[model samples]
Target: MVERRILIIDDEADIREVAQLSLEISNDWEVLTASSGKEGLKMAVAHRPDAILLDVMMPDMDGPTTWENLQQDPTTKDIPVIFLTAKVQAAEQRRYAQLGITAVLTKPFDPLTLADHIVQTLKWV
Candidate 1:
């Protein structure tokens, strides 16, 4: 199988670490992490990962704003993005979906099941 590259963008160090370890161990996927939206956008453009897991609430640049920027950039616009957020209200989910994200994974997620969630959501397997 081809190794997948996933970029995780979140301000929390613990969240980034957990996501990286989860994806790496469960899916054998190469994972890149960024602490802020600006850094994440830079990495997304530079690496062009297969998918980006972005945190909704972030300082300097929120996920929605960052996603808009990504959509404007030709190099990163086509890459799929999945929102990782604590906000799971029906209205908010609808809002996120309207933004054209591939999917949204709620916070306090199961580390072991994260890869499976992504795969099922994206139909990667």
Candidate 2:
């Protein structure tokens, strides 16, 4: 079976490291990471990973805005995005849904189950 690639876009180095280690160790996945939206966009355009795990809050461009930009570009629009965030308020989730975001995982997540959550949300076998 071919392994799927995952791009993680987060401003927090610690979170990116933890997620990379956890996902790479737990599944047959190739992980790429970026510390900011700009770098992430570059990597996304260059590599076109199977999926993206984007952080909702960042310095210059937030996840939703980044997602919009990705959608605008034909190269990255088809890639699935799962937002990883600390905010779990009902109103916030509703807003994300309104923005066409269907998958989200709250921060401080269990690294062991994170990959599983993503796969299930994306309906990947």
What TM-scores do the predictions have? 0.97, 0.96
Output the lDDT of residue 39, model 1: 95
- Model 1 residue 21 distance off true place after TM-score fit, in angstroms: 0.5
**lDDT per prediction?**
0.93, 0.92
lDDT for each residue of candidate 2 in 1-125, tens digit (9 for 90 to 100): 35889999999999999999998998968999999999999999999999999999999999999999998999999999989999999998998888877588899899999888988898887
Which runs of model 2 end up more than 4 angstroms from their true locations? none
The residue pairs that clash in candidate 1, if any, are: none
lDDT by residue for model 1 (1-125), tens? 56999999999999999999999988799999999889998999999999999999998899999999999999999999999999899999999989999999999889989999888888887
Model 2 lDDT at residue 61? 97
> Number of clashes in model 1?
0
- Residue-level lDDT for 109 in candidate 2: 90
lDDT of 1 at 117: 89
Which predicted model would earn the best TM-score?
1
Which segments of model 1 are wrong by more than 4 Å?
none
